[model samples]
Target: MADRIISGRTHDAYMTVRDHIADGWAASVCTVPKDAPKGEELIKLDTVFEREDVAWKSVERFARAELNNLK
Candidate 1:
């Protein structure tokens, strides 16, 4: 997967994608303040998918929606 960092006016979405032993792929989307430390973030979404493309799509969709909501 590629490195993706989605940013909003004051917040940013950081996505982590990894392989799942039981499932095919796992995706975690976290939102944090633009200038805050790494630990200062919230896990906005956590999902598992059967395909890498689908997992990435879901991550992008959720990240974009969260960023848009901040607008």
Candidate 2:
């Protein structure tokens, strides 16, 4: 099946994967404090959900849940 999602740092490789998907996909990242200092051209982990704990797992899960809604 064609990959419909790309979850990782919004770097060159990540952006490339999203660009290749015909149906497009969601991208995500995990970071302490918060995501990238300056937003790029895709999803921002911190913006996906709001919580006191900025754990990687929490942000990851929240991002996945949001992507699942696209299905």
Candidate 3:
């Protein structure tokens, strides 16, 4: 199966999405704290963003969860 990651704005939302997906798949969510250091890696919500960029961000988050053993 094609691997994928899905996310949301909050932990509750993230769990909701995770529950909605198929069985046997893992989920990870990225949460950039409000106090995150100012850097290019931090996603800025000051304006709209590229759709693909957001998609990749979620993928990154999911990978992090796996690396951190959240999955």
Candidate 4:
């Protein structure tokens, strides 16, 4: 299980968390990569949801503050 999460493969960033929610599970940010994706200085926070507002907002805040370094 550990081998899958940090296998150094490119992922859609927030898709794991979204999938967790969709499958009726609670999820939170565990880690984020610092290396920028190709040409971008910051990876886009491309998270969306129909429900799970609190969890989604928490992730958005965390991504903006911790990952993207945005105020």
| Ordering by TM-score | 1, 4, 2, 3
Model 2 lDDT, residue 13, Cα: 12
The TM-score values for the models, in the order shown, are 0.88, 0.30, 0.28, 0.33
Model 2 segments more than 4 A misplaced:
1-54
Q: Give candidate 4's whole-model lDDT.
A: 0.40
lDDT of 4 by residue, 1-71 (tens): 01112212432233234445354434344333534442333334344445565656656465434433421
RMSD of candidates 1 onward, in order: 1.5, 14.6, 12.9, 10.2
- Model 1: lDDT of residue 62: 93
Q: How would you encode candidate 1's per-residue C-alpha lDDT over 1-71 as one tens digit per residue?
A: 54478889988898878888887898989888887876877889888999888999999899999999987
How far does residue 45 in candidate 4 sit from its true spot (Å)? 15
Roughly what TM-score does model 1 have, to 2 decimal places? 0.88
lDDT at position 2, candidate 2: 28
| lDDT pick, better of 1 and 3 | 1
Candidate 2, 19: how far from true, in Å?
29
Off-target runs (Cα >4 Å) in candidate 1 are: 1-3
Q: Which candidate comes out best when scored by TM-score?
A: 1
For all candidates in order, the CA lDDT equals 0.86, 0.35, 0.34, 0.40
**Which 10-residue window in model 3 sums to the lowest lDDT?**
11-20
